[model samples]
Target chain A: MRDASRAASGRKVCLLTGAAGILGATFCRRWRHEYDICAVYRGGRLQVPTQEEWFIDPLSPHAALRENDNPVFAVKSNLREPAEVQRVVDLALARFGRIDLVVNAAVHVDRDRLTSLASSSDLLDETFAVNATLPIQLAAIVCRQFWQHSRQDNQAWGRNVINLSSMASLGVVAGVGLSAYSASKAALNMLTAHLAAELAPIGVRANVLAPTSFPQLVPTSLVADTVVDLDRSDLTGCIVQLDENGLRETPSAPSALHF
Target chain B: MTMPEPRTLQAVNDLQPLLQARRWRWRATPFPHIVAENVFVPDVQEELARDFRTLYDQRTTAGYNTQHDFLGTSLISTQCGSLEVFISPAWYALFTRLFGINEPGFLTAGVHRHRPGSRNGFPHNDIFPERLDVGPGRGDVLRFGGPVAGKSVRAVAILYYLNNGPWAPGDGGETSLYWDWKDGVDTPVDSVPPRDNTLFAFSCNPHSYHSFRTNRKRRDSVISFVYRGVDDYVQLWGDEGLRQYAEYGRHHA
Candidate 1:
């Protein structure tokens, strides 16, 4: 239920999860235009940023486009906590009033052996909680905001959600030690597909940025590429790739000879 | 701890007349490629011919696939008689010429070893990804491409074939260069076949896509070396960091 008014006006609002990490920071710094950004990260830990601080400044890359002079709010709250995700959503809605693009790049890694034949029983539990559950929780919060905004202002734009997936999710992990990490990423990919399907009518888009691991380990190049790719997706479900950070945002016309 | 004999270099120089007549390494201006006919010395070739049994045994003993890529491929190594091996000063000068790093910030003069296989190696890139702190220009478009920050980097690869060995016709194990794609088989400029001790050298990058057509015969090995990061220009190939991307392909090779 996009607010016909905003859609007609063409003002796009965006939000990004995991704003502090290396990749998130890239989004916070590089992608600053095309839409109003609401850069979201679990940064504050205990104290979430106030509405003006978190939603308006938006931690996105371009400082000039910020609502105020320096529009960036580092809100620290875990997506694993449903309530926390909701709170941030509420603040974002209250401040600038909409979230058009959501890049959910936050993920927790397990240092232990996941595919270890001798591991403990809690492997599945921990993996799902961080990777799958966190995205779900964030989605619940965003969807709620989508509905609430539609009801309140009667406005919306084609909002998108991009989740960071992993290479291990597709095939076996190369390193025998990366089983738990790999399985969790795989689960995250499926979650992204499921949410994209359910959150369509609201003019909200959900997608995944499945990236391969480079020696750097963090991903800003990947997210930046996804932003470029998402511009073209017309259907309800889309799974884009962040090939070595060469993501783009073109609509449906096969992209140029990307590296 | 023995030093590689210096006469091996003379043997390579002597073969240059016949090699130049082949007119290899005559294609590209910046990164031209070719297979030098002579890869190893007589002594090195002999060592390579007899090294596989030891190499294969090492793999099973380690309980891993860390073994070699093929069956009968042999090996040859060279050293300047120093344990602390590094790039040569001359190659460093080459990096300064190739990349616009201006300053002599790179280390050159490196070498490597290669062992050919009876099978084709997967298509891959040799460079590693580096981190750059990107800043948005104007609105929100962070155009990322080329050099970032102050870290200038350059990598030069030299492959010295230790064994020319014999090759059957249509064995198809030639190094293929992919200039761009067409219909299906990427348009190739060069596809050097495996011959006796041969040498290959080139700069590496996204545009430098290369792979062996096929190695469906005896194994092969090359003595390889790299002179890397001798300049300021670095590559931001932008292959995103997604391991299992849904639509886009793998990033690092």
Candidate 2:
């Protein structure tokens, strides 16, 4: 739930999941001033700077905003449960008045890659619940809210959903233990595509950003930048892959002209 | 091995008028790509088609997927007398100018012969990130050795259909470009028919995804690659992007 004391009027509302994760945290810190962030982190609250190295800078991106007036509403919720998802949505709406952007950045990675598929069914199930299914459910609820609050004034602002996926989902990035993670992300890609097509008439946009997440290979900031760019652009139902080769639209359409 | 005859260069020069007249259709969707038809004069096209068999001694089976197979060989490795027309300076300039490749790179050409039932080529950009490690002077039966890392990045890929044989839409073997991938190769968004005197080419990048399906007829085309420096690719994609390519190439190479 948002801290009622903070004043974040006029700014767009961003419901960001995986708020504590590397990508999520970076996004929050970088864009704190731009949007009224509803930062959703499960497991625990955002930890202060400690002895251990953290994925994001100890000073949250919203620290300046925090010193003056807080715009980030940190919420803790396990999105797998329907009630929790609804509670978060309801809380966000009550606090921020409206939600303009949804960034489903939370993910479940199966660390135990050695286990066989038959034995790791539980892990696979959990992976799908968090990575793939939750995004669909949350988007459905959010879109319903948008439809209910349809006004020509707010419609012009346009709502957007950006789902963070991995390069593994394309099956081009091969690794032994990535089957479950890959499958779930692939499902997310298809769902987002369908959602984009279906929601286009309603002035809502949905897109998937599949970036190579190896920190050493592709920087985390590049991924964040791509997401922001995707949000700013009119591209919907597009699965944009960012890597060493830069941004490329998957299943790229060939352009040839013949006289 | 026989050296290419001087007249082949002359023939390539004579096609300049037709090449200039060609209206290339370019598109940035999916990725940067271009296509132009009626690329060659009829006489030159017929002559190249008739001599296609001379470019190879014996075609070798190649391709990744089990369901797909085709006979392919490097024309330069064969040193056929007619190979000069493709590797000639005029031809090389046309490719570089069309693709806007600024760097100096070697031009290598190969022929892929796909027969009926040997359909469905896998989608790939033809840039092998792992090939950069293989040092020069290790020229194989497929390609000539160039400077270090020059053999690694394929800057551009151009396919000129040599068979000048009658072709139709249903005949298949159209080099298809895709918009996305599913379990296997999904239906291509656009397909270039393997028609005579037609030229299909694109700048080889990570997003230049393309494949082909050979359904009924024997599909034959001279596939040429412009091998640029690793630095050029690195400059565009960054070191990490190259590393990612290398990593992906390790698993799939």
Candidate 3:
């Protein structure tokens, strides 16, 4: 539940999962002023910097906005369950009355190899549930709300859903046991494309930003910038790959079971 | 060592008049360019398309800068047997006669593939005469003595589309010719779609400002550069350009 005593603000609301992760934390610290964030984390609490600790440094390209107190509303929830994902979406709406962006940054990377595939079935199932299913459920929930609200409001702004993915979804990562992780991310990429195509008529856009390099090697700010760029632009159904050079669009590989 | 069939050469020869007729100046500029459709016979077009597909599949490396994202490879890499069809002495003689140049000075020849969401190249002329330097250890520099004296040799570029069929309107990946830059805007004068077997040729000059953008579908083409006086051309963009091209050539080699 939101603290009703905090004044209802007119800023756009962003429901960001994995708020405790490195990329998510950087986004929260940088975009707090531009968005009223509903920060959702699964395991641990996110330690956001206070105003005294947060100096007036430029956070992003849209960093000119003045910072406000307690722009982020942290919610603790287990994303594996469908009910908990719904709660995160409901909490954002209750807190800000509108959800403009959904950043599905949470991921479950359990190492498993093809040789031990049968032994790792449980972990594979859990990985898919957390990484792929949760994102789709959250998108459905938010899109439903946006559709209902737009019927009454004539000037509804465009809503955006950004799914953070990895390059392993497109190509094999050498020497890494990522069978489950790769499958989950590949499915997530497809979900993003499907959502973009279906939701475009309703003014909702979806895209996947998969970094070609390791997450730690690529700057978090670049990821943040890509998210902002995708949000602001009218591009949909794009699978953009971030590398050392910059962002480039990659083709979605075909599924094995083609009917 | 396979060559284009005699019928293919005849068909291409038959389109010379149409290509010459399509030549026009953009926005009163003296830049000469021609876009001809159905330049090659169906069999040759199919062969080129197959070669490009094989190259695209075997492409292990690609590079991107601010200007464009390109998959650079050669016939040597793909090991396609149709190399002689594109670089035959007869074809060189035909181009020399068609363009009425003194000699066919082949500069660079390779396959270019741009997949969906690739960046559009910026508007710029291909020739940079002022940047050319014939210093020690540098590659051979060709000197022009006639009307183009003191100026570095200008080249003519040919783009042969290897797409299997006609492209839809606004499908992008079309080579765009610009008239001039106005208020930081690239004013497009004409655009040639990547139609099957279509060929676009133009002289690389100061007035030759052109760009290309890839659409959602893949774009494949064979692009070759030919200079008038120079036997070979080397684009020297200071040390950085040299280093980048050396690395690029090494990777694609």
Name model 3 segments beyond 4 Å from true: A1-10, A49-70, A148-156, A251-259, B1-253
Relative to the true structure, candidate 3 has a C-alpha RMSD (angstroms) of 21.0
| TM, every model | 0.40, 0.43, 0.43
| Tens-digit per-residue lDDT, B1-253, candidate 3 | 2243423544334333223223221122225665556655555556667766776676665333334676766442335455334443344444444455564343435677787777666555565443334344433232222233333345667788886466888778887776542212234655678887787777665456677865767787887655543323343222332233344334333
Model 1 TM-score (2 dp): 0.40
Q: What lDDT tens digits, residue by residue, belong to model 1 across residues A1-259?
A: 1122233355456666777776776665555545555666664221122223221111111233332333445565666664777787887777667666667777777666645446665766767677777776777777775643562232235456677767667788665566776787777767766675566545555666667664365355655655545633443354454455464332212321110
Determine which window of 10 residues in candidate 1 chain B has minimal summed lDDT.
Answer: B76-85
Q: Sort the candidates on lDDT, descending order.
A: 2, 3, 1
True contacts kept of each: 0.00, 0.00, 0.00
**What's the CA error at residue B212 for candidate 1, in Å?**
59
- Model 2 per-residue lDDT tens digits across residues B146-236: 4544335788888888673889768888888865332144466567788877877788876676777756988888888777777778788
Local distance difference test values of all predictions, in order: 0.47, 0.67, 0.62
User: Alpha-carbon error at A145 in model 3, in Å?
Assistant: 3.0
Interface RMSD of each: 27.6, 24.1, 28.5
Candidate 2 lDDT at B170 equals: 85
Q: Per-residue CA lDDT of candidate 1, range B148-253, in tens?
A: 3443223444544433467765766666665532212333444556665565555655455465554555434433333233233232334421112212123222
Worst 10 residues of 3 chain B by lDDT: B20-29
| Candidate 3 chain A worst ten-residue window by lDDT | A52-61
